[model samples]
Target: MNDQNLLERYIHEVGAHLPRRSRPDVQLELRSLLLDELAARGLEADNPADAAGVAELLKEYGHPEELAARYHTEQFLISPLAFPAFRLSYGIAAAVVTVVFLVGLGLRLNQGGLDLTELAGFLGSYIETMLLNFGVVAFVFYLLEGLGWIKPAKTGAGWDPHKLPAVKDPDRINRTELLVGIFFTIAALLVFNFVPHWIGIVSWHDDGIGVVPILSDQFLTYVPWLSALWVSEVALKALVYRAGRWTRRLRLAEFALSLASIYVLYTIVQNAVIAKLAIVDGIAKFALWILLGIALLESGWQLYRLLSGKANHPLGVPSIRENQ
Candidate 1:
């Protein structure tokens, strides 16, 4: 067959399995590569007898397997980190995009200025972005699977079923740990809300749930809910730190609860009290940011110790580097 014919079949075979959005580009590139390889082998499209030799050359290049592997390696699941992170980030992005699209549609329907044509145009753009994102993510996972880096184990004699210990505990939150977590969490809340209000950064709420302090400015809200969120997060972190093992289900429950609390608080404050809070504007904000930074560092250090099998001691247990 001619170079064009050879390239057509080759590109079709490979691109058929790839993401549709990227199929055209990948097809073009693969065709070019095949032509170059054929040319390098001294094969000519003009000579009719050179057809079989060209076919043989294409066959030797391996039945689109190597090309598929290359596509996977170069474009998708490049590493272990990339694999799981891609899944998470893609899921989050998809959710955000879906919400934005729905909101835009609702707004357009409510507003009289937006005609059907304009609505269709806006929707077309949204659909395009959604499709492109989905294709890219799918291709990434496909590539990762194609490569051996993320391949499933063959389950042979070398595997020891009993030696692999479980990292999770069914009873994750014990009474003692839970009590201690509540204590520290309550203390932190008192420091942030009550103490700050006493010093004039905010005001203590006397009307409703008086345990949490409310912001002084009517235009600045979301403080109470945010304080509650931070408190819960601190409690969860404490539980995890003290126990060191929790069921996946429990961890997920905690995450959902914390996020829901933040979202609800944000919504209520934005609608009822103030649209936004200027957490970036004051000494209190700066101090809170500093505390957050220190907490992150401490958490990271603790995680490192756990991973390095040195988590026998509690958090803040210094290493040799600290002494140095």
Candidate 2:
């Protein structure tokens, strides 16, 4: 093929990926740039009939998708500004679905001996549910953004450099920890509220399979409060992520949630009775006690910070009172 034909094919491929409204102009601009680059390289565009020359020039230009992607300015359902939050939300949703599927699978296995066919079916359903949840979360965020209900801050738009948060302590707000907390909290809420039966054990014997409930019926009574606490914790962690720094208000919120969590754990530990499994009961009680102790320590630490005015300013932001 002639150099002209090859160049035309390249341009056509790029144009194919571009939006109709901008394709023509983009193609023209691309062609002009290519010609300029070839001329700068001491290559004659008209004689690009030389396969080697055409190859070299085209290589410099990049692939069609790469070139087209650079020219596309349109944002999809989620804008770049809101993408981080959307991603976190999607991850949480996926985690919830996975937890529910796994727990439900265990319950099913206990109730009716493990069957490969049933396991495969559950896997298929789990994937479908995750996809549906992702789509719903994306759509909701799109709607919220469109309605101006959640306006993500844009670059150089009323941003003050001096007000940037401080990060004196590298471990002050661990993003990974917060994200993990968000995922597990959401998963726990889903498992307890929607698929409570999954919180049990499955045993297989010579005769048949047996299922035993780990949580007592009274445990259901505390789920509402537990769910609410989990929801609040998720919301607070999300806010911390968005803010990228901790302030007095956020610290107080964290402390309150931590205290509430300890109380919830205490109640659950006291009332969660296990049937037919003393080991399971012991394990559950021990885990709850450990969690309660951790919560108390966290609450105490946050209270100390707030009282000492350490939480008054963000990492980079200096306290106004200190300046005065």
Candidate 3:
């Protein structure tokens, strides 16, 4: 009821949640700090010395939630999963112990509960073994973290919370970068298809026509290059959904690969079928032109992102709120 009692009660409440090894010392330090804070506030008026008045003052000072939270460290020396919340570690420990206990108890029960007079002897044996194994597992996880096998992610001190830039909804990803992806798709088609035959690596079979190989005979032998071309095309499109400097350039590289693949596919198909090629030649040429048109437009867009330099340093760090 008095100042000392109120501080003691607060200490007892917090100490109950802490590890037994440090509880006494933590309680004493907290008790002294609380008293000091009250004295500084000059709440030492006559009734302030009274237990009820002290209780009200302590209540006004708030539960030491902040003090309690400090005990929960982001220390890499402990399991990332472990914390001041003993229940996290205890639940796992207890569950393991419980399972072992249950198995032992079941085996004994199945033997017909025959040990009536010496029940404590059997019970003690079961608890001891189960707890020993449980403690081993708990300590192993702690030690593994302490040994730096499972490293904790950077937080607090490593990251400059104050340096974080402000976020704006309007500053959503830049629109021009999306155009780069479209451009790459087109450029890929032209580079692979329309290029002069002075660079034909391999002619498809006997036919004068030959399409480029996408996967290559050494790679898969039969799968057409068109498949890889299409796949890369789709992937490039997907990458555009993300707006970032590095990703933007990676998208460009993907586009070039896709285009070269298309060229190889065209040559492979052209060399494989000579008769039907005439029928498909016009259609293929038309497709390449359309792709080139799109590519030109996209190139202009990419140029804009590069000139603006936004593409050069695209935001690498993600927005935390989005992660949540």
TM-score top scorer: 2
Ranking by TM-score: 2, 1, 3
Query: Per-residue CA lDDT of candidate 1, range 127-227, in tens?
Result: 89988998887686667656745542322233322232223223334667666767777776776565654322343566643433334454234557667
Clash number for model 2? 6
The TM-scores of all predictions, comma-separated, are 0.31, 0.42, 0.27
CA shift at 106, candidate 1, in angstroms? 19
What's the candidate order when arranged by decreasing lDDT?
Answer: 2, 1, 3
Write one digit per residue (lDDT tens) for candidate 2, span 133-226: 9889999999998988875332223332223222244225788988998999899989989988777888899989876567767767788988
Tens digits of per-residue lDDT, candidate 3, 73-150, equal 543433323433334556667666655555554445434443665578766876786678657656776776567664
Off by over 4 Å in 2: 1-177, 204-211, 271-276, 312-320
lDDT score, residue 123, model 1?
A: 70
Give the number of the best model, judged by lDDT.
Answer: 2
Per-candidate clashes, comma-separated = 0, 6, 22
For model 2, the local distance difference test gives 0.67
Compared with the true structure, all predictions reach lDDT values of 0.52, 0.67, 0.49
* Residue 58 lDDT, candidate 1, scale 0-100: 57
After superposing candidate 3 on the true structure, give the runs of residues whose Cα lies further than 4 Å from its correct spot: 1-22, 42-87, 99-111, 116-125, 147-324
Q: Which ten residues in a row have the lowest lDDT in candidate 1?
A: 160-169
